[model samples]
Target chain A: MQRPQELRNLFRLPLPRSFQLGSFPLRSHLRWILIRIVIKTFCGLTNTSIQSLERNKVASRFEVFALRLPPRIQPFDLYEAILKTNFRFKQNDIVIVSSKFVSISEGAVVQIDKIRVSHKAKVTAKKFQMDEKLTELVLREADQVYGGIPGFLLCKKNGMLCPNAGIDKSNIPRGYAVLYPHLPFESADKLRLNFINNNRLKLFVVISDSRLMPGRLGTTGIAIAVSGFKPVIDHRGEQDLFGNILRVTMRAVADGLASVGVALMGEGRESTPVVVVRGFEVNEEDRKMNWQDLAIDPLEDIYIRSFKSK
Target chain B: MQRPQELRNLFRLPLPRSFQLGSFPLRSHLRWILIRIVIKTFCGLTNTSIQSLERNKVASRFEVFALRLPPRIQPFDLYEAILKTNFRFKQNDIVIVSSKFVSISEGAVVQIDKIRVSHKAKVTAKKFQMDEKLTELVLREADQVYGGIPGFLLCKKNGMLCPNAGIDKSNIPRGYAVLYPHLPFESADKLRLNFINNNRLKLFVVISDSRLMPGRLGTTGIAIAVSGFKPVIDHRGEQDLFGNILRVTMRAVADGLASVGVALMGEGRESTPVVVVRGFEVNEEDRKMNWQDLAIDPLEDIYIRSFKSK
Candidate 1:
């Protein structure tokens, strides 16, 4: 399919009304060329250091396509549907699936009304000023609740620091909450194998979720599980532009990719459950890596250290 | 200017040796189609809930083009050079410029040898085992030095928590360090005005820098300054998918875009100093927003509360 033209048209939409170029008397196309020429001439006269613009093409280009799947679909079925898309998968293509999708597929949804609230959960709910049923669910899912403000519970679940153990109450049936997928690494591996066996393509799969950064206003992307790629790219011994060896520059490549994916996949009614990230380079040797490769030691975490005094 | 064809060829490169399809008997194209058919058929038989894949068009798409500029170019000159490119800007189009380029343009580079080191700098160098000259520079730039590890000084700079006050020693001339641009919001405004006057186009400009996130292994992008767009999109009081009013879901849209830009403009040898982000929606009223709009009150920050006991 001629997808590039469609992609190009996507970016060629008209500018907003406030930025219209109608102020120029000449036609838009001719005026744009004239403006470009005048700007180049002016720059040439003003800045002697200004040289010819290099046509050095972008070394890596990433195109994110959010694939919408039916609600409550199974994981294997969702994989098959994605494979059936017109967009073909190539080697090293990273398919980032939202953890919510995986959890729904894995039957991780909990009926809040079905839960038996404990005395501790009720007391904690009263103290936190939260719903009793929600507190019971949070208590069951959380490995440790560090406490929170009136409306939330800051906790650790599955070795991850999150609010309410990543129990999301959005986009599910009424009175039901979605849980983070259990054994996400296993789920990623299963999806990877499905892709390989069916399409004969080697692809990286990342199960992603959004989490709030400390002191940041909104949530950024985080990788819960990964398969067929190195989660971190260490640049400790790599030389910088000044020829200085970088000491603490290990890049969380997967997490960054997940952030890009999540940004494209809006948290609200976007319905974009799957995002295809192409053109990223991944190490072949690290194909067997899993979630542990992306996790940080809680004891060594700087934020955890700050909380130590408390 | 047939860029789309060029882009298509870029992704069509041969797969890696480990993932090559030469082992398969059938041709690559035919085998892929066959595999797709087989998967669809198998899925249909096994999963009754499997439905047709919906071709729900992507609501928003972003393409990042890394434009290469000469080293040590001035800010206005850099903006003029960007205007000289074939790609045209429109309303709400985001132009992300690296902070290093802005610093160099603003004459924020300081020669380390020119600094007169103080007794406190010497003591700090001895205690932290860093160069006295660099320590002096950090001391000058840092508003409050919280503490440090062996090599890094954790400090608050310009109302942001950063390391060494975002003083970078890489990608500059020898014996010099690049300081974060003075009044980044002002610089962003200047660039925005340049775009408006030259191309007669409205553009959102983001001055970006890389910073380490706590508990994360690598750096993510942060927006130091922005012009021509709202930095945050408040989703508070909006109904979620489950029809529950969202209490705290304000998104830091500019910061996420910066992260996307930095990921493309890699920290290492990739000389992409500017990235053009096209196809994002921005609020018209937010065009006049400054840095303060994106900042949170330190007293109200949850992380600050955790650190208070220390």
Candidate 2:
């Protein structure tokens, strides 16, 4: 399939190699206007919905729809499953798929009996009163292990703090555990490109996982992987209502979107594995986002940092 | 104004003093059926929409709409502002108002100039590089002071963990800082009753505040207080998709709904302070919920507990 980004490259307008520092915004603004006009003309020529294109510019409101799918025992085509739902994919729409769903689609499931019982895993499992096989899987999947409670380990996986490294034994069949989607960022990027190249529709994709927050009961949503947008909207140097410049008010857009999706996609037999969010527009960047965009270093985290001093 | 809960009490049927343990669900189910029939007949007798009442029984989907209001300079009638939105409040609809809005409406604001600083507050201010007056306010408001960073104190206020004891110097006039609602749970309960008594509509009210999670950027929504429903839906003893009994899978419904509201109510200059959510229904309870319903002891928290041993 031809890359959809080729269309943007075809419309590239070169600027002067050097410009005044203060003129950066004006230059970018001029470039944005030119791209908008070109894209508008292209949409008109191609009979695409101009309203959808315009809405992406200043859309504030959002409508989230849950797409329920049957439970799968084996890997299946996620793209075809989405199409089977008959939900029309629109430009700039956000598609949030559960990490468990993604794992199932990618055949990331493993039988508990198949895991090797490493000595460290066995010791850790004994201490935490967890299954040794699950402990091994968690250790293998985690980037860094912090600590554990009974039957669960709190760890940083893919720069996100989650218990059990986002592994799932609850939703799948007995004795089979599901690991997080192998290379989640790449998987999301590939899925995003499939939509873009096949239908000429650029949309965002988030691999979401439910997480328990500190000092709070129940789980909220966190984005394990994201594609087609900057995960965080940095609001540095922007004035608050009191006119003081905000230095640390970055909006974790991806995680927020994930939470919205998780609210609809329950962790039970409701069977909703996919959620389609429309009218939630963000700056669709071509550059692929990685873990750094949404997560802070554990040392820099207030909760983690405070624990050290104590 | 009459308390809205009296209507529920009027229809309370006496239950058998003792029952089989397995028959509890059945008894509740029968009671629920009876209540539904009575409410439906009552709606038929009155001019209420029976469809709205029926929809509450099985509402799995939700549509959140943001209601923008002008910035207030002083305390005003929150009920009237909601009425001014011209939004219809239906039975079981969830209303989420920002804590800042509630604080303003209740005049939970203080001028920074008029605060008396104690020795502890002065030491804290100097240590954290915070204003002495603001530190004094946070110290007073906090239930437990954990620690601090450069400019913010991490404290537990009303069973919620937050920085600066949930004090706000933003989104209001300069030289004034807004505190958390003096009695958040009571405020939410009172507002819910206003809707029920005035409009004859029983709706859920959530006092929401944006919270920054550890190791993540941007703030998601948390319900500081909720009325008309249990904040957490305990899935204990319920089977997961794999038929395994869930032990620690309670759904934080109020917080999830609040996050949906905060997504629409942007923290910037959007001016959206009220969000009306429809089609998301939970069991309506007459019991008033305190902070204990949603939060655990800090010592019991996994994140905090892990730190103690280290």
Candidate 3:
């Protein structure tokens, strides 16, 4: 169990500063009391009254735009391509790039003809009813093969459960496969820095990939790496609507944001490799963070506990 | 294994109608050629060309607005309160209502003082370190209790793996708990019909709730029930970016939409129980669909396969 201080730090909320109410000067106390009364008046109003107070306030909205980039985009040219779409980047805007696009930019594509398949690769390929070269790639890329049905291998790649170790043949040239970016976290950080320097704006960058959930058809977006904000919002000490203190509610903000991006970046020929998510209010701090913040330790994970390792 | 015909039906995509390309009538052949040329031209364009072609095209966007409603609202008045927010409803808009709001409207609040506890409830409560009456309610609401750590219960409610069977204490009046709606699908359907009748418009209705994922901190939205659209988009035979046919990719459209809504609906004090999600293109079919379409069968689920049922 995490200590309260550590939990607060992990969730990136500021620790409350201690202050002595009794030590306040006489004038300060009067000001404080007046402020308290105003706040109390605001809180005492009914729900509708409070809403009508801010009826003109625009609600937070998000626009998911798919940038139609060329199929074989180099990593160095990705930023220019995104800007060419003429979508203006604002402070705190979330820019999501598909990992496949990042891989291609990083020159991570491998032509199948170059891979010399070994005996183990051939045997595993035959057993799994997959192509020999693809099986070899899956084995090399995966930390551990969890065994999968024919045509797919469930493997742990960078602490994530992925099909074929995220070695995808899609969106790449024929006879080649696109590996996940060599360093997704570094990739996101570099992009964030570049965007900040070039546009002089604060923003968040997320490298996203698709993954299937257990028993759900189709894939939802998962955040492979993120920069410019804390990934999780811990609501442990917050009170629920019933005034009951909530103990175990934390929002996976990164994953939820990635899902929003991926829903617009469809898997088909929509050709949207990048999406711009705006209007989400995120902490503006651009501190260094790791994708591990979103990862569940294998031991503590309920799904992993239930998993019978093949 | 599902037959190709049945798979197509389950995914709800239209099967290709058999026609001989060589035997097309003269006018039909001309039309086909024109369409082929247009599509080829669209596909062949570079990023800049495509952007310039549709320079004024707005990207798919969503706005999540919370409707502030008085507590203890009757179910019939919920729709009127939502409309009173003054947000315009357009064709194919998705209106998401928090299930807690739905439950409160349905008069599903249980006063803890009025409940009589059984011996089983009392012992189980002590074992789980929870309130005895709440445990009794959890026991009654749950289909099967899977045991839990202190202060939580792992149970199945409406075939969903929910904590405490979706019984919530938050956001309700004092000394009362809110139960999950008796018939979520019916609730969604009724809302959809009411919206259509009242506004003379087309739209999707989703009743959403928050739930924790197996090793993740915080909660994301899950769709309890949805009407006016297909919950899942199956991409079984669709070709991936690599030109290889995809076998198992089904997009959980409803859940993804729910997550988008829930991300905007903060758990604490953001009393916006209703959200209006605009601008995602959903298949606008008013056919009756069950929430079961989005459920994963336990036997077939990878995560469930590993679960050691207590």
Where model 3 places Cα greater than 4 Å from the true spot, the runs are A1-54, A57-59, A73-76, A113-132, A145-151, A306-310, B1-59, B73-76, B113-132, B145-150, B306-310
**lDDT over C-alpha atoms for residue A227 of model 1:** 88
What C-alpha lDDT values do all the predictions have?
0.69, 0.76, 0.70
- List model 2 lDDT by residue over A66-163, tens digit each: 77677886999888777666455678889999999999999999999988989999999998899899999999999988887887888888787878
- Can you tell me which runs of candidate 1 are displaced by over 4 Å? A1-54, A57-59, A73-76, A84-87, A306-310, B1-59, B73-76, B84-91, B119-129, B306-310
lDDT of 3 by residue, B136-156 (tens): 999999987766766777776
Choose 1 or 2, whichever is better by lDDT. Answer: 2
DockQ each: 0.18, 0.17, 0.18
TM-score, ranked from best to worst: 2, 1, 3
lDDT of 1 by residue, A1-310 (tens): 1122332244354533433444535555543333333333334321111112322333445555566655563334657656655454667788999998889878888889999999999998898788999999999998877767666777767666667888988777678888978888888898998988888988898998877665566777878888887777777777766676666776777777788787777766667788877666776544565445776644456555533523
Q: What share of the true interface contacts does candidate 3 keep?
A: 0.43
lDDT (10s digit) by residue, model 1, range B40-150: 333322111111122224434555567665566334565765665545455767899988888888788888899999999898878767889999999999887766655
Candidate number achieving the greatest DockQ relative to the actual structure: 3
In order of appearance, the predictions have TM-scores of 0.77, 0.80, 0.76
Docking class of 2: incorrect
Candidate 2 lDDT score at position B280: 70
Candidate whose TM-score is highest: 2
* lDDT agreement of model 2 with the native: 0.76
